[model samples]
Target: MACENMKRVQKEAINNWRDHLKRKLTGQSVGTKDWLSSIKQQQDFSRDDSIPPLTAPDGSVVTSHRGKAQVLAAHFSSKMTVPDPEREPPTVPVLTKASLGNITITTEEVLQQLQQAPAAGIASWGKRWQVTLAPDKIQAILISRRQDAVNWDQHAILLEGRKIHLQESVNILGVEFDSGLTYTSHVRKVAKDAAWKLSCIRLVAHLLDAQGFGTLYKSQVRYLMEYSPSHGPPAPVIPPPP
Candidate 1:
């Protein structure tokens, strides 16, 4: 009874979805405002990637390209620490064997500075080094056992004053990882993408010879399915090409 109810509900939902698409896409209703609006949205997506004019910090709308650039420049410049002119070294001597001297930097000073000012602390070592940590492009994942239902959402990992919240799964280079190390997300995604490619190739299968079809299958479809081949559910056994 439960399975029958589920099947009925699913059928109704699918029919409703099809009806919605039909109204939006086919017959006289295609002339409706919703259809036009949908087409316009698609056009906006396919084209028009131009950035809109930005408002400057000083209550001015920068319409020109050059003004917009200056606005962006000022915005990014505020994030950086200003260099002190007074701290400039007075020495003019170039490095040579005679200029080489013993290290003046103490280990304790380094440790103290690291602890005290983690965001901004630079006692020059052998050479000047710049902080390359971007405000964006940082991700973190937490891995744990499936039975462990402990929620650590309250805690956060901080680096360079930025909060990096933990994720159950994080994708890196198209591969997904989760807490349990099952890699279910990555395998499913790869499988779906491979299936789509195979279906597309199947449309034109009759045009290609067996050898050509095999080549395309090996290069495009098979390669995607074979990626990270050791993991997840195995692909179904398909009969050899006749």
Candidate 2:
């Protein structure tokens, strides 16, 4: 009977040690994940491709992979080309002090003038390559302090003879800018998106150890919040589960 009691005590001691080790490892894993997530939020600048494909100049939607690539290539090529020194530079209208004082300038008029100013340069470039600008893909945002200052309904910008309506917000690169220049909307959007992504990550948490989970969080959730071109509100902090 004494032998059996001694064996039982030994088994209990082993089980306790195993449990203690498991708990310690789990704590370490959690700490590592937290650290990785933090590092990712600071450094990651990756963003998902959510923007719609550009429409070609022919008025047909560029849906195919090759067509989309070609459109992007053409657009970027035109922007990157150097102006020829021998070629006469395109004339741009200069806004003089006298013109500004004499004219009863509304926001719409300013927008129109600015829109028209770029036409000469674009036309000169298009003449060389025989490539026309895609009006549908061009977007405009009117930045103003007053909410009613921009006449969105009345104001329309023309590019290559096609009229394009103004947008309340525009995403240039990965950053989003609204008409008011406030980043509240952008911050809210990033937070909501990160929350959704975290929920998805939770499903696969078992598949990944702490290190793996941390890496995933950095690449996906943290990246969305960190990459911004303009100064805005801080990203919403979401603490990891204890």
Candidate 3:
């Protein structure tokens, strides 16, 4: 009788757990324990591998996992070190207003300042923590409405004595930006990706009910659509005319 009672209790507990999960997935509030467990599961699902191998200062690639970790540690350590306030500031060429009313600095001065920046930042961290800025990864983009007026081929920015190549478009973070500064390309790409994800969800629609599908759509599809760059102010919304 005791064995039968225990089996009955176990079945009831399993049914209760399933009911709780269903409620939680359907936008209903769950217990603190359940909520925390769900968050942990999501975190585990989203966790990815460590940083990939990067090119060292001498141009040789650090392919080993340990080498990549060390590179990242040194780079971050240099960046995080506090600068000494008592230390004399590095001399940099001051920008002045030109005859055309635009503020300008000499190209030579700009190059000099760029060269000094890395050394100044890492000075506090010492030689062991020094990080080399990758020249090939550096991108320069001119933000001008007149594409024809801007001669990209003729102009180049030098960093660490190497000429930084100009690109028509570059992906900053996850968003794609072009010389024109239009979000059209980014929007199109995100839409295509979202469509693909939606197709995948549709394939498994038979296994999920409306609530489960809605939850999945919000977490995966809606997130992509809402993502925006943090650097700039958001676009203002225009109200309809009464």
Candidate 4:
């Protein structure tokens, strides 16, 4: 669950940074972006504030706060750092549009080195699942988006083994709904939360892009990056049959 933890920590840092910026913009002096650099260091989030914050006219208190925010943004821009692009590129070739519709291709091997032995912990309710390996060790696990069809629309990855299960049971006549019943997978026990799966998938796709296994067109990445956790933190994991 390292990725999940990372996301949690990253989200907290981002919110704190945003709060810092808000405080600065609202006529408060927030230390430089690096002053609270501890947040950035804790998570692998990109801290590039390239576009300066819009400022109010000079001398106005609100404007002054906005101006300070701009200053912080500028400082953030100056501190921008990314892996040297010129350094040796990843060895894996990127998947093209022709490969996009294919559901068979996965970049699991890229994270094969990351997979470690299972951990010794037991499931919360005496369930059959055991948390395996190092924290965040599971880079990917296949989940069926659809059981009958192998379309890309029905397949998803449990990047950190988080699943969403509907809490309240609904009765439809004589049939009982058992969470995500409509979204059945060949492999059952998938996370029912759409946002969580999307988050994991988005991050997995990002990691793949970073490794040259796949590409994310800019607009798509922008949209996905803007996805917020409206429901809640990712759901806990449920084990599948061994």
Model 2 per-residue lDDT at 232 = 33
lDDT of 1 by residue, 1-242 (tens): 99999999999987876665555465321223445555545444322324456888889876666787889898888778577857977887776657556778654554454345432332222125654665456556655443354455554445655565767788776678787877888888888878898998999999999877876775666656544443433332233332
lDDT of 4 by residue, 160-228 (tens): 464322122333332334435542331122233344555655766746744332222222222222222
| Candidate 3 ranges beyond 4 A from true positions | 1-129, 228-242
Better of 1 and 3 by TM-score: 3
Which run of 10 residues does model 4 get worst, by summed lDDT?
A: 230-239
Q: For each candidate, what TM-score against the reference?
A: 0.38, 0.46, 0.40, 0.17
Ranking by lDDT: 2, 3, 1, 4
Q: Native-vs-model 3 lDDT?
A: 0.64
| C-alpha local distance difference test of each model | 0.61, 0.66, 0.64, 0.40
Best by lDDT: 2
User: Candidate 4: which stretches are off by over 4 Å?
Assistant: 1-63, 79-85, 89-143, 150-242
Which digits, one per residue and each the tens of the lDDT, describe model 3 over residues 1-242? 99999999999987876665555645422333445566545444222333444887778888667787878888799789878958987898769755475777665664566447654454445445775666565666666665674455565455545666667778888778888888788888888988998999999999998777876776666556554333332232222232
Q: Give every collision pair in model 1.
A: none
The window of 10 residues in a row where model 2 has the poorest summed lDDT is 42-51
| Tens-digit per-residue lDDT, 211-234, candidate 2 | 778767866776565543433332
Candidate 1 TM-score over all chains jointly: 0.38
lDDT at position 166, candidate 1: 66
Give the C-alpha miss distance for residue 17 in model 2, angstroms.
31
